[model samples]
Target chain A: MSILAVGTVAFDSIETPFGTAPRVLGGSASYLTLAARYFCPDVRLVGVVGRDFPDDYVQRFRDSGIDLRGLETDESGDTFHWKGRYHYDLNERDTLDTQLNVLVDFEPTLPEDYRSSQIVCLGNLDPAVQRHVLDQVDDPEYVLCDTMNYWIEHTPDSLRETLQRVDCLVINDSEARELANEPNLVQAADIIRDMGPETLIIKKGEHGALLFNGDTVFSAPAYPLEAIEDPTGAGDTFAGGLAGHLAQVGRYGADDLRRGIIYGSAMASFVVERFGPERLYHLNRELIVERARAFRELAAIPKLAPLQAA
Target chain B: MSILAVGTVAFDSIETPFGTAPRVLGGSASYLTLAARYFCPDVRLVGVVGRDFPDDYVQRFRDSGIDLRGLETDESGDTFHWKGRYHYDLNERDTLDTQLNVLVDFEPTLPEDYRSSQIVCLGNLDPAVQRHVLDQVDDPEYVLCDTMNYWIEHTPDSLRETLQRVDCLVINDSEARELANEPNLVQAADIIRDMGPETLIIKKGEHGALLFNGDTVFSAPAYPLEAIEDPTGAGDTFAGGLAGHLAQVGRYGADDLRRGIIYGSAMASFVVERFGPERLYHLNRELIVERARAFRELAAIPKLAPLQAA
Candidate 1:
């Protein structure tokens, strides 16, 4: 099963309390595709980069087994560049600058082969573009879409149209609350589910994430780290891991979703341990398995005999 | 095995976004003892109340199977009274009033029978009082102490001394950070564990809790609720349920502690569903078991074979 990821492929300058990193390889598609490669070998990336994009970085993605058939190089413009600074608590950060150079007039045109991808991950991008990609895919088994407050508030009609087509929608807690206009997350999930997608994942940064599928709900815990070097692209990475696992398993059962969420959480955990995608560069199957096992242990509760009714 | 709880027995006036309750039956010991009774039948309550306290409320404790031999009535002053107002988000609250009436001259004197209790729960109170209860109890198998930020700031010496004697300590995340002077929770847990208790549970309000025992860490998710009526005494109730479950199980294994935390979380969840202790009044073993099972479902993850080393 192949997983298609469509989003930004750009450069990021990140500053955290611990340290700072100059123009590093970043972007939604970059993180998502790299994380997805851990679970499934067939990960196809679709995004645009400028001439400024390094050849070594491009080689890194190719080395990780990500298909770049749909990736475009716009020699006429600069790549998307974002500068961000994190506060004392890494949960919140401010975007210092966002130069949408190549992304300004971006249009995603799925490659002929990518039209039959088993799973499609639409990263945080213009909802119109997400819908365009959706139009191209040939009945994807799973369509997982990620968005932010920007589209939800400014272009809700376009976002809602995208939501109606996707199988799952992933967003942070605040964005979930805003999108549904409900403060309570459970109720927010209910409202959002009613809007379109049957599955909704409300990510709560350090708190973890909640997966809502109709009447069923699953709670996943964040990997507790002593220090979080950088939190950029964690959410996108989580979405990729989740969709990738589902693609590999080729099922949508409750058990498979639960395992997917655990794997996704583990991938995101590894991403935040270092600046940008450096940690993911060193991530291996053994470390991922170990972390997933830790998650199992962390949440494991012994079965207690059913209590007699009082 | 028996469990002993020592803390305030007073009245609370609470205002939330949903509703308001005036001078209801509220206190640390009241909630702790009530929640504990659900797990351990022999729950000993030690606290001081004023003559103004209602006999009906006192009878409620007696009817709930809480041994009140250590409770005192200070006719000279009024009962401890707390008035609080919760913000829209229910996570933060403002203390409008704190009339430490009977609590001002309070001193916990455990009864002869309670001295032999297998577990002791020292609720949020002066560290000196918690230390006094520990001094009186006969070498109990477990001593679980709960504290707040006020004591951490005003009486560091006393709090430290109390921490040195307890087997386990339960406090919220902020207090843990402040007490350890470490902003990071994992680091904070490490620093606090070195101070005394081998086991530490850092409660993160709605985000849930973290259980740290040596190198082992267990994360518990707070039951997600669409409506929260009142949050008073949630932490104390959690402590009571946790210690009480341990007492009933008569063991301190990792499995037992994990079950205890889940039960504690469930009890706290039920408490916030309604104002004061009204919800707990109707809480039965069936409901507790059902909620615990729900928690199991909410966090349940399938075990996957370890991935091959890359």
Candidate 2:
């Protein structure tokens, strides 16, 4: 099975209480490609970069089995660049700069060969762009979409329209609540599910993530860590691991969704452990499996005696 | 096994997005007694009340097999009363009124029978009063305590002094962070464990709860609910179920602690489903067991791969 992910592939500068890393090879695609490489080796990435983007970074993805036929490099402008710094909690951060260079005019065009990928991950991007990717995919079994509050607040109609076409919707807790106009998360998720999508995942940074489907809800807590070097691409890393692992399995049920959350959580733990995408870039299958087991044990406790009604 | 709980018995008026309830039975004792009834038929409660308190309300506890002999009534004054309103999310609330009648002069005195109980719960109260309860217990194997930022800020010395005597500490996430002066919760729990308690449960309200012991950490997310009528007494209910079940088992290992959290989470789910203690009042063994099973399902999800060291 092949996984196709389309999102920003650019540069980032990050600062944490530990220190600052200026101009790192970072972006949604970079982090996602690295994190997913351990689970699914063959990942096809589609996004736009610029002449300023290093060839070494592109080569790294190629080495990790990330197909870049759909990647566009424009010599006219720089790559999309983001600069952010972590707050004391590491969960909250301040964005110092955002330069939409090649991304300013990016209109993702999927390669002909990528049209048959089994899994599609539409990372945070314009709703129109998300729709365009979906249009190009032919009978993909799973389509997961990630969006921000900016789209919800600015282009709600287009966002809602795009939401109807996806199997899964990934969003932050606040964004979910804001979009639903309901403060209660459960109700907010219900609203999102009703709009479309069989599954909804509300990320809560260090607090954890919640999955909602129909009347069923599954929650996985974030692996508590002592220090977070950078949180720049943690969410994208989580999305990539989830989509990639699910593609590897080639099936997803209630149980599969649960397992995907654990894999995503374990992947996220490494993403925050270091600046940029360094830690995830070197993650091996053995390490992910080990962390997943710990998460299962941490999440699993025996049920003794009588249970509350089923 | 019998459970001994020391806390205030007060009335509360609550308003939520769901609706409003006027002057409902509330406070730590009210919720604790109802939840503990599931595990043990005979639990002793120590607190103060006043002339305004209804006889039927007091009788309710007595009928539930609670030993209310330690409840001292002051006919000249009124029962403790508080009024608050919850936001739509039920995460935040604004206190509208607080009339600490008999509670203002509360001095917990354990009944003769209560002194022999093996389980002790020290609910939110003055640091001095919490310490007094500890002094009264003969030899409690599992003594759990819950406190708030109010006491931590006002009586740092007394709070620190009381911390030395308990086996487990239950506190809100913010309170734990504030007490330890650590921005990260995992680190905060570590700092707290050194203060005395062998176990620490940091309550994150709707986000669920976390248990930390030196090198071990277990996290549980709350069961997402669409309708939350009232959140009053949810924490006390959680504590009651946890302590009651643990006392029944007569164990305090890591697994036992994890199970206790599940029990607590189940009880809390019920507490928020109705106004005040009405839902908990009529709960049966089967109903409790049913909810417990639901907690397991709500929290249970499969994770891909096994955990291995990096």
Candidate 3:
């Protein structure tokens, strides 16, 4: 099975209460492709970077087994750069700057082979671009799309058009409320499902995520971490792991989706341990399994016997 | 086995986005005793109410199999009254008024029979009063105490003195942070555990709860409900259900604590479905079991197979 990811691949300067990272390798596709490669080797990344992109960073992606055939190089302009600062509570952050140099006139072009990708992941990007990518790919087995409040509020019509083609929508809790204009998550899920995606996952930073599929709802717990140096790219990494697991399993049964959520959660937990993609650089399958096992234990409860009347 | 609950027994005027309940029977002990009665038949309630308390409400406790021997009636003043207004989100509320008539000078005295109770649940109250009740009771099998931010800030010395005597402490997330003066929950749990109880449960309103015991941590998901009429007494109800379950099971094993958390979560979920204690009036054991099963299913994830190397 093959998975395709489309989003920014650029540089980020992040400042958190713990510390700061200057122009580290970041962007949605960077994190997504790296995390997806953990579960599915045949990952195709389609995004643009400027001449400012480092050679070693490019080599790192290649070494991670991500296919870069669809990646575009814009030598005339600088790479997209974003600067952000997080408060003491990492739950919220303020974007200091966003320079969309190469991304301003970006037009994603899928590789010939990527058209047959079984799973497509659209990271936080322009809804118009997300829909354009969907038009290029043939009917994917599963399309997982991620969006932020910016797109939902600015370009809702385009976002809705893109969402209609996605099988799953992954957004944080507040975004879900803003998108549906419903504060209640259950109601938001219903409204979003009616608009398009059959599967809706509402991510609640440290509280974990909720998976709503038709009549079934599953609550996934976030892995408890003692140290979270940086929370950059946690959501995109989550989406990547989820799409990657689904691609590897090649099925969307309830059990499979639950497992995928756990894998995604585990991956996100590791990503937040250090700044940018540093944690994933040294991550292994064994550590992922161990963390997933811990999650199972954290949520495990003894089977209840039938209630006996007193 | 017998479980003793000590707290307020008073009237509450609650207003939520959905509806309003004026001057309904509401208080920590009122809800705690009601919820605990589902699991433990011999629930001893120790609290003070004014002579204005209705005869039928007293009969209601008697009908629910909750011992009222330790409940005191003060003829000089009115019952403690609380008026609160919940925001649309239902997670935060504003205390519009607090008329602590009988509770202001309240002194809890456990009945002679209650001294031998196997489990003691100290609901949210003055820490000195909690310690007084603990002083009267013999060494019980398990002692669970709940507290709020007011006491943690105003009476730190007495609260610490009470904490050292309890086996377990349960409080909401914000209060945990405030009490421990640690923003991060993991760190806060460690700080609190070192100060007193070996086990700590931090409740996160609609987000569910986390149980920290020794080196173990268990995450319990809150039951997803479409509508929540009133969130008053949810925390106390959770404490009641947890203490009651532990007493009925008569064990403090890891498995038992996890089950107790789930039971507490379920009871709290039902409590919010209607204003005050109205929902619990008609709730049966079968419904509680069914809701608990739903929570288990919501959190159940299939065991992950070993991740295959990509």
What is candidate 3's lDDT per residue for A158-257, written digit by digit as tens?
Answer: 9999998999999999999899998788888999999999999999989999999868899999987888889999999898889878988889888888
lDDT of every model, 2 decimals = 0.88, 0.85, 0.90
Would you list the rank order by lDDT, best first?
Answer: 3, 1, 2
Specify the poorest-scoring 10-residue window by lDDT in model 3 chain A: A301-310
Instruction: Report the Cα interface RMSD of each model, rounded to 1 decimal.
Output: 2.5, 4.5, 1.1
Cα TM-score of candidate 3: 0.98
Candidate 2, residues A127-204, lDDT tens digits: the string is 999899889999889998899989999999999899999999989999999989988888888888888988999999
Question: Which regions of candidate 3 are displaced past 4 Å?
Answer: none
TM-score of each: 0.96, 0.95, 0.98
| Candidate with the greatest DockQ versus the true structure | 3
Deviation (Å) of B64 in candidate 1: 1.4
Ranking by TM-score: 3, 1, 2
Better of 2 and 3 by TM-score: 3
Q: Point out the worst 10-residue segment of candidate 3 chain B by lDDT.
A: B105-114
Instruction: Return the lDDT, model 2, position B207.
Output: 86
TM-score of chain B of 2: 0.96
Tens digits of per-residue lDDT, candidate 1, B180-203, equal 998788999999999899999999
Best model number under lDDT: 3
